[model samples]
Target: MNPFDNILDDEEIQELRKNHNHLRIKFNVLSIFTIIFIFSGMVLFKREKFPTYLEDLLNQPPNRLLHNINQSNRSNYSNVENFQNSLVSNLNGGKGTIQLHSQNDYWRESPLFDALKSGIISIETDCWYLDGQDYELFIGHYKYQLTNYKTLNSLYLGNLNKILDDVNSYNYKNSIEGEEKKGVFNDDPTQTLYLTIDIKNNPELTFKTLQQNLEIFQLKNYLTYYNTTSNEWFKGPITIIISGENIPYDSIKNLTIRNTFIDSPLYEILDISNQSNHSEFELKYSNQLSIFASSSLEKLIDYRSSSLSNYDFVKYGLNDEQIQKLKQYISKAHELGLKVRIWDTSINYDSLYNSLKTNIGINNKGNNNNNIIWNQLKELEVDLLNVDNNVDLLNNDAMIAAIGVSNNNNNNNIKYHDIEDNYNDINSNNSLS
Candidate 1:
């Protein structure tokens, strides 16, 4: 070691030390800037104001869609009637609209995809054909790169012939009159599901494989079919999907769905209402289910003023009595065999949950609009829950989700079941962010 050091030039050694020091200093400075840039991007939108939230947006109605997923003010969606007609009628034409999300939203990374398993009425997941494997389980269409939390595989490959296996399975038992269950991954008819798989691996192979799988169930014109192969969207029997190229990578909804399932490999639309598309077992379980409503019509359907320029949905302020009126629509949707739910009309969190879970009268929560939203949803006895939205969705805290449902709903008394029973597993992650 002494001989080698003597051979090295003094000037060279000095140069080496100076270069090393400079690099170290530069690296430290860069690290600080990188962190700041990342966090700054989180709260700000389009390099401007903070991202809009459902609550704040609910409080403030816009005159028109300030923003949309695809092109702005799409002539295709220039009017509200045109949009509704596209979804409810002319099902053969037009792509379905998906609400993009932001990373800051609490639901962006929770277990929404998995949580959907228990009482899901409708499920939509995009597919990617990148992997050549015979099957995929927990990957999303979006490619993950340069994540702060982890490293991702750095290649893009794809496959063909993705099947919603266990799509139709039979379960038999001896209970109060044993019954057989059907559908992919469900053991009970009362637990059927409408699974929307977005396929995009091998375009040509997707349809053939999906059709082949449909035969496995021998569906009775009720539970079969998917447009998972194509990126077309429709509200009818044949619609497949909307393009993925335009999605805001940071959207809350996108992150939630992405973390939940595997990327699809084909293309085609899946409509749960299409009885011919599924078997009886699937129809019974997934076809008709419940959903909640917001206090105001605008909030209930997410019909922003910009989205529905013709109707001044915001001009008519929502009140306690008016919130109850929303039940009329819920009942109407129910008549079509859908469940009804009400949420987000007010700020009294605890009282609303207690009343709904136990049928007890609310004491702490006042005669506010949220109370009415809770009462309306509970009285309807909705089978599903679209619960409270926490601004800090990244935390995925059950304390936020179960803010009020635990205390009890009836008898002005808190019951044990409210906390112990009728709630989703807290350990499981959520994507409500």
Candidate 2:
């Protein structure tokens, strides 16, 4: 017989069967009730329009979510693979002709990789220093939106380092004459990636943190620097130009050999030029300290109206008076061997600029006065055109055709510099927002 088969009698067996059936019925009823409760809760939640508490429970803020995603092991490999593929694709393509400024609105995309892949060498970030229990540097347009995931190292420095290494490896293998390594733009290997770091907080702390973090690149000799003693510039693949927050001049000046440069006040330089006393005047600015002399484009034009028009163009665009002032500034800066770049200008394809075009008159093909401003700047031979919609601004057929054409004076071989204006800094209030 089977071991212990006769443990229960027929009546006992019947009682046991009844108990099991009753328990199963209770479980089924409980499960159905649970399902109904969940369904009802979801409907109620949706109808209520997502309350604060509900939002906290149901959804996480994008930055926080991104932080978690970055920390997680699941997508690490995929992200790396994607980045590698993007780098390879970028390397294979012709470097974009324009200096594409990926504005604050486009930060949601992979900031560094996306812009680089698009062949945009220059990028700006509104940097904030976050010092708390967990000390970190964060980048965000506003203070409230700061997140740990989208940091300087994560978004820029690390990716830059990787790109540099990859490019160096490629150059080494290719072994071209005087091409040991290249920058993000392989076609123009000597072109420096202009990284404008606009400090929105404690300049000393933030910049110190930046310098400490960038030590790896510095060690690799991958940063542009000026040897003050030798009076020579060693232009590397990447140049970090610090702007905003008055930018501690002494801090920058104290450094013997430094890659970090400041954006000199171009408008102020104009005032300093018209000084009544030349004998008592002392040079307050030096090109050794700053590579670029930049200023507000609106201020430069004497912002009479809220629109960029032909009137504005003629009055301000390379006129005798404006050109004289511009020439003075350019001459002084060029004497110092510094390039001039005017900011707060028109960025084609930007809606803000387009909206201002109502009074300015758009072309039959929907082109705005951007071309006029661009051509005028080219005629003036502005070293850098700070503009938006870089892809279009660079490849605009009209602008390209106008490049080799003669100006009013019939000067052949007109030149164009990379456009580096970030439109996010432009505000509705007509200031640096």
Candidate 3:
């Protein structure tokens, strides 16, 4: 070390050390830049691939994000204005009628509101009147399911009254002098929304309670009623239909004028004209007393047969004989000036048998059975298509195809009958019926 120090000058040694330090600093800076460049390249590659990956992910079934997006796109009306706009735009000029059934667990107020928003024309609610309660009708499928807050007045009638008040008041304020008052729908104000009430217990007491509850609507002139004095039935925004066994026909049948109408038994339509063949209940039904004739689909058609499989029924729909029987029932009801509504058509035999075997009540998840039944019913010209679950009806592709009109279309002049014709045309080549 001493010999090297002597041979080299101090300045030369210092210069050598400075050059080495500069090279070391340059290498460190280059290393950092190389790392940043690699990271940026990775980010760019991911960005390019992400969209396709996301699309693939969305295409997969049961994807929550995709489901949410579809739901929003299907039914995005979150307010009154949006709902009204959607209703007018999607309306098929009263050609087809859809009735929302209150069979699901979520039947309190939200389902009613959702149905209205979806532009459904008819709605059904099951009611029970408590012995101790005063003019209060509770809504639930069973006695054990009833809650104190969910009442016919609070949930349905009160809300309906309020909606009518707002709509009618606004309409009156912008009146055209002597024109008759309009109903809920802006496009077709005269179209009355049917409200079906299925009484669960005590027909007399429940009927009385329902009548008392409807006083507000009656006062507001928002209810459909028949005027015996004028021998005419006046159309209003809402029509109330009562359905149940042991109905107090005596109470309302004799009344000179009344708002509430009865739901006649469809099975007894064949014997209605023949007084000798008519039962006590069948004798009470008339064009004045009832507006809708209804029965379970099974009562009209023999869908349950050991020889035929459930899958075949779901695929092929009603056979020739069944169709004839159904046609006769519908024709008779129509002849009597009563609309026909068939219920218990959404049955999934496979699911039902499985449920029976399992002893666990699970909801039918697939709508193939419902879709097939609805198509046949539509082809048959059922006035009100009773649907148990309408959550995805407005947005379902199959339903839209069945309707033959898009809900998003801006064309306001498309009549429902035209849509029906279009549907018939589309299915003419290969119809389930």
Please report the candidate that would top TM-score against the real structure: 3
Residue 27, model 2: Cα distance from true site in angstroms: 15
The TM-scores, one per candidate, come to: 0.29, 0.62, 0.64
Q: Stretches of candidate 3 above 4 Å error?
A: 1-109, 170-180, 272-282, 305-311, 349-371, 402-406, 409-433
Q: Write the per-residue lDDT of candidate 2 for residues 96-202, one digit (tens) a residue.
A: 43433444412533455545544555677888888771345788888998865667776678667766754453222334432324566644555677888888888
**How much RMSD separates candidate 2 from the native structure?**
12.4
- Residue 422's C-alpha lDDT in candidate 2? 29
Give Cα distance to truth, residue 112, candidate 3, Å.
1.2
Candidates 1 and 2 compared by lDDT, better number: 2
Instruction: Please say which candidate is ahead in lDDT: 2 or 3.
Output: 3
Better of 1 and 3 by TM-score: 3
CA error at residue 10 for candidate 1, angstroms? 48
Which pairs clash in the backbone of model 3? 92-416
Best by lDDT: 3
Cα lDDT, all candidates: 0.29, 0.57, 0.60
Question: After superposition, which runs of candidate 1 have C-alpha atoms over 4 Å from their true positions?
Answer: 1-124, 128-179, 182-190, 193-303, 306-325, 340-375, 380-383, 387-433
Pull out the clashing pairs in model 2.
none
